[model samples]
Structure formats: C-alpha cells, structure tokens
Target: MLHIGNAQIPTCGGLTRRSFLQVGAAGLAGLNLPDFLSMKAAGAVDESKAEVKNCIMLFLVGSPGHLDTWDLKPNAPADVRGPFKPIKTKAPGIDICEHLPLMAKLADKYSLIRSLFHTSSAVHGSGHQWMMTGHGFNNGDPHPHAGSVIARVFGQKSALPPSIILPGKVGAVGDNLGERAQTAAYLGSAYNPFFLGADPAKSDFKIANLSPQAGQTEFRINSRRKLLAELDAIQQQVENASTVAHDTAYQRAFSLITAPETKKAFDLSEEKDSVRDRYGRNTFGASCLLSRRLIERGVRFVTINHFDTVFSIACWDMHADGGSLNNTVQDYERHLLPQFDQAYSALLTDLDERGLLKETVVATLSEMGRTPKINGKGGRDHYPPCWTNFLAGGNIKGGQVIGASDKNGAVPHDYPIDPPRVLATIYQGMGVDLDQVMMPGPGSRPIRLIDAEPIPELF
Candidate 1:
C-alpha cells in the first residue's frame, strides 16, 4: 500500500493505488490524464527523434473555388473565370486573386498545392473527415484527427493541452457524417483536441473552461482538492483502468486551473492593440493571433476553424442560393478573401519575425474545392475533384506550385495529390518518420499513422 496525506492506497502490478486514484480524480476534472500516462507507458515521444516543434492548421470550413482563387484561368470565358483577376505575386510565375494582395506580397513564404482531390462524397462532412483525419470514414470507424494523433504521440509539454482548437468545434455544416473525425476516436478521449468554446475577437472574450467558477478562491479550490482526494481514497476500492484514466484527467484539470503559465498562455490582453489590429479585429484574425501565442507556449498543434459552420453565414461555401446560404462573389471580395489574406499573411510574417517559423509548420486546408464553372445562382458548388491548399514554414520549400490543373481548372493536369498524401506531407514536414512511427489503433493494435507516402517533391 502507498500513502498520500492521510489516505492509504493499495498496490496493483507495481503501480501504487494513489497514482491511480489521482488519475481518476484528474479525469473528473475533464483533462485527459490517462493519455499522458499511456504515452509514458508506450514511450511514444522521443525528444531526440522529434523534428518540428509545432504546427498551426488554418481550416477553411467552406471550400474555396480553384478558378476564383489560386488557380484562376484568366483566358477562360467570363462565367467560368469569375470576376476577380489574378495578379503577379512575389514568386515569379505564381499569381493569386487581386483581393489577396497581402498574401501576394509574401508569395515566397508559402507553396501552393493546386491539385488536391479525394474520391469521397462531395458533402462537407466527408471532406472534413478526409482532410482532418487523412482517412475516409469507414462506416462508424472514424480516424483520429492529425492533431489528436500528435497529442497522443508527443503528449503535453506544459500545463496547457498539446492540441487545441480555437473559436470552437465545427458543427452542422450540411452533414454530420465526418464530425466524429475531429475527436480522438480509437486513440481514446485523452488525446482529444481542446476546443476553446469562446470567441477571442469579442470585447468580453474569456475562456470559460480555463477560468475558475464565480467566487471560487485558491484556498477553496485547494480545500475541494483535498475533499476530492478523500473521496478518491474511498472510490479506489473499485479502481480500474477507466477509473485511473478519469483520475488522471482530474489531476490535469487541477493543474490547469492553478497554473499561472496556463492562464498567461490564453490571455490575449498581453498583446498590443497594434499587433491585434495587424492580424485583423475579426474572429478569424483573433484566432490566428491566439494560435501564434499558443504555439509559443508549447502547444504542439493549434487548429483555427475560419468559421464553425457553412450555413447562414458569409463563408466560403459560395452557393449564392440567395437563401440562408447566400454567399456570393461580393462576400468573397469584401470579406472572406481580405480577412484571410490579412490574418494568414500576418501570421506568417509574425512567426517569421519571432523566429518560430523554422520550428513550426503553418498549413491552410479546406474540405474540397468549388466547382470549375459558375452556377445559375452566380456562385460555384462543391467539387471534390480538385482544389488548392498550401504549406509554409518548417521544412516546406516556399514559392513553388507542386501540382497543376488543366486550362479549365477542372482536374489534376499533372501530379495528382490526394487528401492522405497531403496529410502525410504535413506529418513529414513535422519530422514524423512515417515508416518508423506507429500509433495504437482500435483493439490496441499497432498500426501505421497514415498509409500514403509523403510528397517527394516537398523534401
């Protein structure tokens, strides 16, 4: 038996009962304590073997159209080409929409993948599953998100969670089939991405999850901890692996609540007004700024959902149906493109200036691309055949276009890249050796993190 304070803990298989009790107690606090314990048990992360220290994933919820954005066809018909004209970027042959002027100036900082496609359904959820998890949903066996996989492999570096999603989790958005992909899935709940349920852009923004309850003082919290420990001592009689996992989560929650560094990490007020303004004052901008802060504070991965859903908003899903989903070219020009251009460019510049770019990988991804031709509603529809996403910083070479589409911007005219390959490339960029590294899959079976090989050209 092992003793902590006034409680006596039994031993099981060389592990003290007090440790298991603490894990169960921490689990009650809503932190995935078991995940850390599991990683320690499996020896997943080896510091000597680690490569990239961090990553920020800017997930554009609604797919952007290739013709209207990156791979614009200036010589195509008026309806097919859309209104915006491509302008020369800093990189010699590359040009993007005129609205993305800020991004155009920083062309040498990033590389565009013009031929990303998947053979899955065109629904938003399907693409979400594929792009986020690197796997198509097979019945209900959803794959773990890339971030969750990272969290599982590396564990937390500080009191703050390793994987975090800003603004909130993706909801609704046409279908819910792939929504589960955002979760830890078979890797277990301990590796789930920490979703910041509040908007940082708001004047009254506060992380409700990180803040203590009203009138709850440090002394009171400590008293409650003691009480919980006493209760855990009693409950330890029925202790099991699940109970230990719960206790571990509670321990993590307690650490987060009391840790000044965790509070400082999430505090945006520390940033200058000018700095905040540079990223833009909107939700997306604030999220981008927060992502930088999180990365600086030892978060391995931060995912910024540009928008939580595609319905009833001026999102990239430019169906232009003139209904709840009425997003048109005007919205893109006046809002989406400009907002993204500022936030993205600012993030890259900020990271580069802070010298974090070399240690971090910044990636922009979407579910799919918009259709090649314009629709009757003056907008493009979903097209899973082809689209454009980009990568920058870390080991990724900048200012180069990897793949190409035909004149109509319809299909992959050159080297065809799929969702898994893109994900594999990201892992590779992060210094993960796909051949040597394996993750624990369903039924505790060891399995490859991803099946596809990384893009050779990227190296």
Candidate 2:
C-alpha cells in the first residue's frame, strides 16, 4: 500500500518505498515518438535545411571496469591486473582490452579519455544520471537526458522522433535512487525520449509502437481524424486554451500510427544480411544497425542501452559474485566485448560510407567503473573515483586520446575531466553553441541547455 506518486510500490520489498515513489513518477512524463512525428508532419516543428545530423549512443548499462576495458594494467599485481590483456590498437600508442579486437582495429577512428572521474555516489544510478544527463545529483530532482534535451532544442526531423531510446528505457538499477537525468523534467511530456519497448536482437524483432493492427487502413485513419476533430470542437468550448495543445497531441499520435516512412526506420528487414552480421546479430549489435537506419531517415538522436537488466544477463559488471549477477572476465571475452567491438566498428564504417560520420557523433559510455583493486570474489566493485569514456565523429578529434589515468588505472593523473564536459563536447560536435541554445525551466525561465563547457581538445 506504499504510494509513489500515483503508482503503488511495494513498501516491504527489497528496495526502499521512497525509491518506488520515484519509479512511479518516472514514467509519467513518457513521450510518444509517433505523436511528435505527426506534429512534425503538421508543420508544428521546423525541417529547414538538410544539415548533417545524427547521434548514436552505446550506453553500457552495467559500468565496465576502466582498468579492464579502455585502461589495461599489465605491470600491476595478478589480482589488480585481472584477466584481460592489452592489445596494441590502430592508434599506435593506444592499447585496449584484447577481447575488443574489432574495436582495436578502429581505434584510430575513436579516442579514449583514460582520465575521467566524478566523486558522485558510487551507485549505478549515480553514473546513469551522470553519463546519461551529464550531471550528478544526490537530490531527487529529475533532469533531462541529453537526447531529450536535444529533442527539446532541435525538435523532430522528418517522420522520426528527435530522441529515441533503443530496445527499452532505463529501469531499476541496483538502487531505487531515481535516474532522473533520462527524463525531460520541466520540459514536459512532449519532449520525453521515445522508448523502443522491444529488443532489436530477437528474431521476432518489431517496433511494437510503430506496428499497426491488421485491416487498419488509411480510410479508417482518416475517419478517426474526423472523429477527433469533432471531439476537439466539443473540448474547445469546455477548455479553450488547452484544446489546441490536446488536439496537437492527438494529431501526433495519428501520424506515427499511420506513417509509412516511420515504420521503415524501425524495420530491420530493410537492411542486408551482411550488414546485420557485420553489426553482430545480437541485441546491442542489431540495435546499432537499427540506429544507422534511423539516422538515415533523419533521427536526431538514438541510444542503444546495452542490456536492460544486470541481474541475469552477463553484463559489464564483472563482480563475479558466483550468483545471478556473477559476471566474470569470461563473459566479457565470450560475449560483451566481441559484440561491442563488431557493432561499434560496423557503425563507424557504415556511417562513414554513407558520409554521415562528419555529421554524427558516436559516444561509448557507462555508469562508472569497477574498483582499481580486485575484490575477494576476484571481481572489482563499483569505482567512480576514475574511469574512461570516449567520443568520435561529428566534430570530435579522433586518433589522439586527450587525458590519462595514473598507474594501475586508479585515478586521474592529468586533465581530470568530469561527465558534463563530455555532454558539452557532444553539443559542440553537433554544431550547437552551448552558449546560444537554451531550454525553458519549470517556471518558464530560460535555462542554459548545458551548464558545463565543451572539452576543447575534443574538437
């Protein structure tokens, strides 16, 4: 009988009741992409120039250990060094985990920020808020995800939604501490990121929201629009001002459900088998390929959440606890690393082939990293003290890494950059002057789109 906003949450459950309250309120601002697309169709938003625009984010759900992934330690002790070895990358001096061979080959195209840290709460939600929204928060005040912010500022492009979260939205991590950064907070429900509820990796892959029911035709749709128009006339008399907004919302819903181009953007069948194989036929891999399709159709932002749940899946959290969450180095080698390597390299190659590389930025990020010191279970615990995240393409400078971590990959030794700088760099890469573009706050106050400055070296 515990209450979280309007939703009832289990009070006696493992997580706190307060967390459930946050969860209940989280989905309240959920957005509809088709509705946004329909609005675009009605000329509600601008689609002026065919500017080079696109972004694909690979969000490693469970934070990967920096020492194991981007920053390897061969000289350190056996326990500290862990299992993976460093392999020389195409970037010459740069070396990444051996398991990521495909990524190593394309290392010249991407840069790894070895020195990155934030002293936020050492929880998964903390990093999710940080990497996803570019700010750290202890208070439960929700913030907009970078993609949603992009949507609020740039609006929709063609029939596709401006911001999209692939496969599914972020759910309960280990903690109920709300990951508010993913929501479009004060921007309202109109600007929330579109959540693709189904997994792209499944053989029966389909965008549930984009799918139309059998026998539903244009004639039926047009009739529904007429009916809605009549209803709008009635509502107009009851609430004059609010009627316009509600009508706009209704039209948006129709456009998405009836649009042909929007459906194609979500259809994987349009892609070649070889292309699918190149991206790796797995969940994260297929999602990357789908992102490319969406970008081709003018989707402004696409995020591929690596995995939805960290409990049963063999995720990046290598806390080999010998239980359901027990993910060892073997899991990284056998599945995660290779899959990411293939998908990421394929996305880079594909985007470059289509000449979208210069206009699109690909960011590989995580919540945080594992501890510098190995735990008793031969796995590393959560460590936010230091880690690594990287950006490529768009206006980002590749080939050379910007920062460095100390020995054993413990802390930032030079140019300690936080998460906001990374978000700022993305905005800059997208040709948005962080100083120029601003969004409205709760009280209709103009708030700076991002409070931080872009990493100069990234450009």
Candidate 3:
C-alpha cells in the first residue's frame, strides 16, 4: 500500500477497485469501449447518436509562449519574429511552429482559435481558475473545475470516476491561491475530479491512489467494509443529512473496491509496445495515451495536465532566464515541440483509427498566451490580450482557423473571443444544452451549464 498522507491504501494489489469506489456518489457519465458499448446495449448512454460525450483536455500548465508556438510571426522584425521559422500546414495560409512537424501533417484534424483571451491576474493559479472553472473566484468561494462541473451535471456511467485529472492536480504556483479549484466548490467534495498521482511514463509506474497496502488482503478489506457498515448503522440511529451522506459514501467505497475493470483501467502493461511507442514513451505523452484509456472505460471528463510544475523540466512557458523557471527557444525545438507533437498527433490518429475520435472531443487549452513581441530575456512575457487554443473531434469542425491575431501576432484583429466561449463550445460539442440541463448551484439555485453561449463556428 502506498502511503498518501494519513491513509495507507492497498493500492498496488487491489487499490484500483477500492479507489474507484472512494471517488464519489451518484456521479457518472461518459463511458468508453466495452463499458460504453455495454451501456449502449443496456439502454443507458446512447452511442449511436452523434453526441460529443467524452473529452480529453490537454491543460498546458505554466502556459506556452504564444509567439514561439501557436501564434508565430515570421515576417515581423528579427527580434519580434524570434529565432524559429514558421512552417505552413496542409491548410493554406495557416503556419505554426517549425518544430511541430507532426502537427502540421494533422492540421486538418483540428480547428485553431487564434484569439482566446481572459482578464485575470498574470499569476498562474488565477489564469487556471479562469480557464478551469470559467470564473476566477477565491477559495472562500471556489468554483468547480470544468471536469467537475461536467461530473456534477451528467453523472457517471461506469465504475470509473466521472472526472479525472492525470499526473495529479495543480499545486504551488508561487502563491497559496486556490489550487483546489479542481474540485466541486459549492458542489461539495463528492464532486471533485479523481486525481492520478503517479507519472505514467515511469518504468515502475502505478496509480498511487490505486495501490493496496503491503499486507492488506481482500478478506481484510471486505471485513473492514462490514465494520464500517455497522458503524454507519450506529450513526444512522440519529440519521440526519450528514449521516445519509455518509451512507452514500460508504456504498461508493464498496462498489469501487468490488469492480474489476477499475484495476484493468490503470494497467498500462495491458497495452502493446507498438501502441506505447506511438504515444511517445514520455511523461506527457504516456499521460495522453492513458487519458484515452480512461475515457474508453467510461470516464466523463479526462484532464491531462501536461506538466504539474513549470520549474526545472522543459515546458512551454519559455521564460529564457537562466533560472528554475527558465525555458529557452532551444527547449521548445528539441523538447517541448517534438514531445507535444508526437503525443498529440498520436492521440488524434489513434483515436480516429480506433473509431473513437468522432464520438469524443479533444481540446488543447492554456491559462493564457505570452507577449506578442519578444522580451529582453529573448522570450515572451505573459499576454492575456491574445492567444490560441484548439478543439477537434466530436461535433467540432476540423481544418479551420476561426479567429485571427494581428500582423505582429498580438491582440485579435477581428472576432476577439475569450476563454468562456471555449468552455461553452466544449459543452455544445459534448451534447450539453446550456439553455437546458440546469445544474444545482449555491443556494440550490438551478444555474445554467455556463451563462455564455458556445462558439457557433465550432459546430
């Protein structure tokens, strides 16, 4: 069993089954593969309809520098154009970073929103809140992560948790801001997204949350469950709202512990070597492949945080300062670009070949973009004024660039779209009707999925 703070979970041997139950109560939606098809057979969630049901969100934490990656400006002055040259894609007049060669080949598979912006503090957590929850509220008044919201609204379809975040949740981003926004704020802890604490790329990888204790036998687990049932019986003597909640939690615990596929979902060795190579046998790349796996098992919203921390490791936030957070253009060409291209392209191609692409919506999002012009450090500064994000699969239109940035790759010259629209568009693609399907919010008020409407063009 791996020790996580106070809990010594029996994760290694039988933890996946237990962890699945421990996730939450009555929260399910989004199913994958055998489970999804089984549900379709059982008349649960339909697969024949062209509804966008599953999501694989690639959260580019620490944010990618817009100038170096998506919004390349080769014609600008030497400093403005930066070091890398822009390469044309299959789509005419649409150029991306030179290092994204694989992505260039798959340009027709996704649509780029070249003008996504948000008005939030330049701090990473603030932008995370804005993009994650569609509102940057504080801990005292937290908002649900987009995945958590989907969980609360739709409900689970299989034993796997409805919402999941791979490689763990976001942590310390300079300040002690609301890092737990990945939770269901006023919606209660029962709706939080299930977090995968271990790195998928590691050779000895195991889902930390799914590992069982060293000496924890299945019989012992079953015995403990019975004891909890009896203790809950004692608590129910004076039954109240909280007691009822405890009962539901207990049931969820047992259900997960008893599920077999929950164990299968975390078993990467079950995949072929050729498949693993296609996803690029790296941390971020493997995580992307796992996201597809979880979705295939009935997970609703699967968020793959490309990197948990922006420091030390090669990430997209090309600060270029020779320090902890430094990420130069060299890193982009050799590490970040190729890693992302290989992984993302593999995900799209694999999903399409497996016949899952048309039923799932895959999105690439970031907190915000970097400056339009180059910085003194030979990189770009934070720029909330303009950036780029993309959406594909499901009901979204492919082979299109809906918005445009100015000549310098600065602010939007036309059709200035913000982050909220991205979330709204995702909902629309996922078969969610914002005008209907109201979710209970604070004070038991029925709140719309999001107040904003989905971008019509994404359809």
Assess each prediction's global lDDT (C-alpha) against the native. 0.84, 0.77, 0.76
Rank by lDDT (best first): 1, 2, 3
Could you give me the TM-score of model 3 versus the true structure? 0.86
lDDT of 3 by residue, 183-268 (tens): 87755455678888889889999865666678888888889999998897777677343454345446555656667888788778
Q: Estimate each model's TM-score.
A: 0.89, 0.86, 0.86
- What TM-score number comes out for model 1? 0.89
Supply every candidate's count of residue pairs whose N, Cα or C atoms clash at under 3 angstroms. Answer: 17, 2, 22
RMSD of 2: 10.7
Regions of candidate 3 where Cα sits further than 4 Å from its true position: 1-50, 138-140, 233-250
1 versus 3: better lDDT goes to: 1
TM-score of 2: 0.86
* Tens digit of per-residue lDDT, candidate 2, span 149-187: 777667665667778888887776788554576777766
